[model samples]
Target: MSRHALGPEIHAQGTRFHVHSPDADRLWLCLFDAEDRETRLPMARDGKHAWSLDVPGAGEGTRYGIRVDGAYDPGAGLWFDPDKLLLDPYAAAIDRAFVYDPALAAPRGEGADTAPLMPKGVVTAPLPPVAAAPPLFRPGGLIYEVQVRGFTMLHPDIPETQRGTIAALGHPAVIDHLRRLHVSAVELMPVNAWIDERHLGPLGLRNAWGYNPVGWFALDPRLAPGGMAELRGAVAALHEAGIGVILDMVYNHDGESDAWGPTLSLRGLDARSYFRHEPDGRLINDMGTGNSIDCNHPLTQRLILDSLRHFVSAAGVDGFRFDLAPALGRLPTGFDPEAPLLQAMRADPLLSDRILIAEPWDIGPGGYQLGRFDEGWLEWNDRYRDDLRRFWRGDRCTLGSLATRLAGSSDIFGEGSRTRTVNFLAAHDGFTLADVTAYAHRHNEANGEQNRDGHGENFSWNNGVEGASANPAIQAARRRDIKALLGTLFCSRGTIMLTAGDEFGRSQQGNNNAYAQDNAIGWVDWTGRDREMEAYAFALAALRASQPDLQDVGWLTPGDVEWLDEQGQPLTVAQWEDPDRRCLAMRFRRSGLAIFVNGDDRPRSFGGVSVPARTVLPIPADQATA
Candidate 1:
């Protein structure tokens, strides 16, 4: 049995509340009535640094919070104020919306009572029956990374009331798109209860991406008005359609920002125990999100593990893509693959067989831990993403690098067990596929950061023009590059992830970091979508599914795959390093693929050569031919 089943547990008689606060001298359970009046009950401390209380009338749907009384010193990392109501760390449902107010964080002892404005944790009943489905996504499966809110925000098929909600993902039109693309998993972005960043509120913006998580167990009411049942139904629908759901999780950090940030949840309950801090009490900002969670702490580890179990057992999610996962494996000594949390997850019964992926790096020391996780864990291969982009952009000495990535990136993931690379060209973090070919530079002025928010160098080529161009020649060239990039991605060994709108040539106008722009800039415009480009994507998916070599789950043995130059001969070291070579061919079993990228402004071609029957389609082939 898990040690930390801390939350509001309902029974036939009443409900019992369990909370962890080792540093608190006294704890009180605050219950809110329908008219907003508060009733306080003293809680008893248990032997294992926990507080417990039982109320006879408190059953399901009771709104409550906790207030711990202890030292209110920030330098020593003891922040306990009874004035500011604290949310349960394991809250399954939040009754109201969370609005960031600076006054809620006023230096511990100086802040006014914030219970009137604070949201309370609701005692939720057990969720609906979670279908016992086997894991649908695997090592070589294709994952479609999408945001529940932004994915169908502007879709014409979704009803206005259901648009931008988790229920919208189950609409027939959305499922049809996934089926067409042969997507095995839908990696839904953060749906956890989160708050808009404090800075964003001042800047007249909001956190469009739910990376700033607040409550670990509850679903954001804004995204899931119907609560866990709504999300479970959506997951059931996707499961019925043979698609798995991989949630993008943010346990690395919380919505609580810096020392001056809001005292919403963890910071108010037990800041010293919940968050990592320096000796003098300053936060460890490894996540680049103001504060890094104390992932290695015993209590924190149990909280995270329990949350994983709750999602899998109650909501029926297939897997999780951990954002900033390096923080989870980091300890005071350094990053250890054998970290307790990592080892526990690997050994756990509920999570052992599920898909676990890592965006395997943070902004801390030794943070660039790409391919450093355990064998069972898959990592987002940024090396594969960058090298593929640079090769198609005609960068010098890229043929050898491209070949390495095409063959499951043995350089990064190592040899035999390296086939778990999550290969991708574009993700939610950077520019879209169409924007990569249409704009060479990032245009993020819309983010109110003076066009300085996103990555400086995109490894992109604009086909001679900087932005959108009217010339037919440039458009044709850009479209050809798009096809070439998609060809390499599908043909690569290992798992492949496609961003939501990239299949049909969606553009962000060059706003790579549209994490703040929730309006037209971030939403996927289904109206007037590029049907031709979409068809091409469908064809590539079909081809990948049909080809066994492309979906190979192990490192290719010596004779399994061969790389060739444009002349249909084995690639020489000299030719591989040649800057002038922009064309390469790959042969696997009976099927062969040839990619010709004209990154240069003028036309370029290679001598005609005959290949095997399972041949490469013409660049930008007709949908019928495809």
Candidate 2:
């Protein structure tokens, strides 16, 4: 019952494609030449819902699409309206914008109206035509997490049309800012194709963060002006600026979502095999999104591996930050350190050399596997975030905790090397450095989830004021605390990640979980520049750049780093255990570079310690000794 018959002769070779509708009665392969005219080539249907059309000149710079015919069942997850054009999951470059139309989601039932919820089909541009080879800068990389749209949309200098697109990120003004900031890597939030949650769309909100992924190989047309071409151009621009690009990828689950979710791309193609299901054919909800991908399965693994290969080989991405990485390693029983996906990535020639960052936790049982990752992987140091927050917030019993975290959390990561940890005080998901010292609790009513969306245990102190205030004294205290946190993050022995707008004191107006608030709340406010915040950020970056000890690869031990009391002498057991004695000093040297950290809130005037005669301490302008 296939629509197109196999041609008498196989004239073309080395041309291939895929079709998702296995049960379809018919399928057709349509191609357009460089002039945008249809060639209407015939296709041979394979047994497994796949189709092939071989045309010698159709190899590259050719535009293609698939057409299918079948029953359109909305509730049962089968939306096979052949009348509607579909995009190929493996498309190297997308060409057009997704025009918003409700007819695309029209229900098949008689008299049923479906004009409001339909998403438009995006066209893919040919590869190599949209390809660019961007150079990589891996070693000594400083990652700055940012959102493409949010980063430039409000910037006054960016052109009106260029704002909120990948092209905007490459603007000379933007590039100059990044160069001045001294960040070597820009870890962009998820740019993979995604669907706005139905609830959000109905409520006049959008999935601003792009965490809900639908197509791994495709770039979200929403973030690009000329589709994937703009993305490639942006990467090339960043490379010209001497900055590497790291994408935040979500492979644990798809945007098709749980049972109630729509049949957009992968789910409609192969539900049972692609997704982890229950014994009764129900969806597995390990990701808290109604379905978890069966990464253990070969086909599913190939999907993920192919997606990664496409990014590196086709899109020119330098690295990836796996979101909810623990779920990818989960087996039927529990989490496996040597999961096939992990092993494959570690062994893959293309991926091994690039940076691999793991979020390291999910919502599943026994999900928190902090330090269990392999030697080559870098994990987000959640414990460091917690311990630093506690220490600066003046929580009781935090002095002991601070020491362990400052030494790279040997308790969590073991006492081998500190490079495995990615020390950070704040990231995209939670409070900014400014908000951490200004808000006591999350005010997430703006998220429309009844203030129950974000984390409850923030371990944050507002320094006596819940939110922003005009009081000079309170503002000064908050500014000092912000500097202290930045100092701790950069001074710690591990890879450091600074939130994008935190350098200039960006806040979400107390909305810790601003995933859905894509407006000014999420955008980087370039207009509002705080002199204190800028000075602190620049000072920390300069300090880290100047000191080799802060970025050391070796681990600290009792024999190397000695903790001293305020009196310039080593601490005793009783003094070390005392809760009220908040003041402590640490001295350590790495690669012949030495450093000392004073943890007390008050200044500790200790006598000069012995050091090489030529050694000098690099202090900030305000703190320099005459």
TM-score on alpha carbons, each prediction: 0.94, 0.86
Candidate 1 residues 323-408, lDDT tens each? 98889889888898779999999899888888899998888998978878886888998888888888777677556776788788
What candidate 1 gets wrong by more than 4 Å, as runs, is 1-4, 128-131, 416-419, 590-626
Clashing pairs in 1: none
Q: Could you give candidate 2's per-residue lDDT for residues 349-457 as a string of tens digits? A: 6677778889999998888988887777778989989888877777666466777776767777775532377888889888888899899999988778899988898
Model 2 is weakest, by summed lDDT over 10 consecutive residues, at: 609-618
The stretch of ten residues in a row with the least summed lDDT in candidate 1 is 617-626
Q: Tell me model 2's lDDT, rounded to 2 decimals.
A: 0.70
Measured on C-alpha atoms, candidate 1 has an lDDT of 0.83
Q: What TM-score would you give candidate 2 relative to the actual structure?
A: 0.86
**Alpha-carbon runs more than 4 Å astray in model 2:** 1-16, 20-43, 47-49, 54-86, 95-140, 415-419, 590-601, 608-626
Error of 1 at 81 (Å): 0.8
Q: Candidate 1: TM-score?
A: 0.94
